[model samples]
Target: MKRFSFIALAKLPIGLQWAVLAGGGGLAGYALHQTGLPAALLLGPLAVAICMGVAGTRIRVPRLMFRSGQGIVGLMVAKSVTLGVLLALSEDWYLMLLVTAITLLISAGVGLGLACFSSIPADASAWGTAPGAASAMIAMAEENGSDGRLVACMQYVRVVCVVMLGAWISHLFVGAGDTHLPPIAAELPFTWIGLGMSLAIAFLGALSGNLLPAGALLTTVILGSALQLTGWLDITLNGTLVTLAYGVIGSYIGLRFDRATVKHVARLIPVIVAANVVLILLCSALAWPLSYLFGKDFLSVFLATSPGGLDAMAIIAVETGSDASFVVALQTLRLIGVVLTGSFCAHLIMKWNARVSR
Candidate 1:
């Protein structure tokens, strides 16, 4: 009977699929606000994700969800990058590099700690689950013969941690009441054009099949923003759309953890938990000092240091009064940097660690 109901639930249409995500997210957001825990906003998506995984695994749906979600996320990321961020580079490339390097070290430390404590191999575990860039990390891990299951586990674990922790931390500082919808109502006329352009860019980006980290969102957003900047498109990124995307991405990420994977590593839960704690602590420690040096708040610094999904961090940035532009800018830059340098770093680290172990 339980299985029957589960399967039945899984067969819902894509429209209904989105409804479930939105409804659940709103409810979660409301509850978090009531409790004065802004970051607890992730709870809704987390629950939805677990459900999506349980249901999605058993049923077939339009692959559109996966593709569209990817497209929108990538475009959003790409669009968010602007002349301002590029300008930041000219003023202080060294600071950006320093921050990026610190984050890499922290991300690496998480990978190393996981390998030492878990049954996972150092190289596989390290590259498989590093939180900085999922696409890059997964690719590198596969290239290097890392255990896929372990890599997936590590990646998802970090995702969960960052999502949950970021929300929690944000709520602690930014009052929950302040977490209402975006200023969409005030910018209604502007939004129509924005939506049109966003959709066009999203579709085109998806069709292009680029697999860069946050590829779809990055692509669409860039194209859309360019259109907007150039007066070619009149689009508005209302709060509703942002929230919708956030929930969708979070749910998609959460639903990816299937039963087989969970069962396979049930015993390693403690290690995953430990690794999460260590990584969070290490990132916080590193971010705190940098925050002081940069004259920014700790949360912004922490978000920059966070090895979670770029989308999630950006969302947190918007909610927590962090310099959303700066966070997005640096995070994107670091992601590109990670894509370029991560494999080499992993290679050297794995080799050195292997030599020491032997």
Candidate 2:
């Protein structure tokens, strides 16, 4: 009966498909939130969407909506990255750079190991495991004649693992206590005009950010951070709007997991998953020493170093009451490092794999 019901649900009209996602995702999110899990809004929708996707539902969140979600998240991150955060980040610039460089090396080593031992192709392996800026990695992979689809698959798979494990880690280290949503009306202090301006900025940022990979989010972050720092604008997003953004972003990724991609990569799934887990574990291990080095909570530093989606990690950082500013700064720095050095790293990994196999 359950299987039959799901089959029927899969064949629903596009509108009904959307309705199911919204309702199911919301209920799931609420249930998880009640359980005090951080990032319930994101993880719940992601899980539901993935099921809908694997079951072959024709559900697609519009591109603009996805970008808007990113924009909203970008602004959220911007609000967190204040002047004190800047000074702190600057003080530890060398450490951050060192960590990023080490992360890239570890990612490359993982890719090389995969290429040499696994059934996955070398090009795919090389690009799939790039540690930060997934969009940039995918684009760069394709530009360099790597398999873009597989690269995307590998990137998102790692992202899913990172988020799930990061959540669990947060639960263990920080304790998931009191996850109920704050009252929307009292969530933030903003005048009507401030809210209007915030939305305008998000909309415009998403509209104008298509020129680069993850540009909408990055652009919004830059714009919002500048305006907020200059005291020219105040961000005023309520809980409802932010939750909607989270739902859209999570749904966007979930809807992309069509049956075709899954079946095509089924044979490679084990190794891919193993690789992601290894990368995550290694990163988490680094977080411990770094936490002590930086005098921050383990969760804050862990979230900063976790090779997850920036938006997802940011949400977790905020929910757990960690140092969100530190998380954002380090993540932004690592993303920049990854984009700048992806090609050279890919080449090096590929070459090492070739030599080892020979």
TM-score of each: 0.83, 0.94
Let me know the TM-score candidate 1 reaches against the reference structure. 0.83
Clashing pairs in 2: none
The positional error of residue 279 in candidate 1, measured at the CA in angstroms, is: 1.5
Looking at candidate 1, what is the lDDT of residue 241? Answer: 62
Highest lDDT: give the candidate number.
Answer: 2
Highest-scoring model, TM-score: 2
- Where is model 1 poorest over a 10-residue stretch in terms of lDDT? 58-67
Where is model 2 more than 4 Å wrong at Cα? Answer: 1-5, 179-187
Which window of ten consecutive residues has the lowest lDDT sum in model 2? Answer: 178-187
Local accuracy by lDDT, each model = 0.65, 0.83
Q: What is the lDDT of residue 64 in candidate 1?
A: 49
The C-alpha local distance difference test score for the whole of candidate 1 amounts to: 0.65
Q: Candidate 1, residues 235-349: lDDT per residue as tens digits? A: 4556556555555666667766766777777788678767776777776687777887777788887887777677777666755557665676677777877777777877766
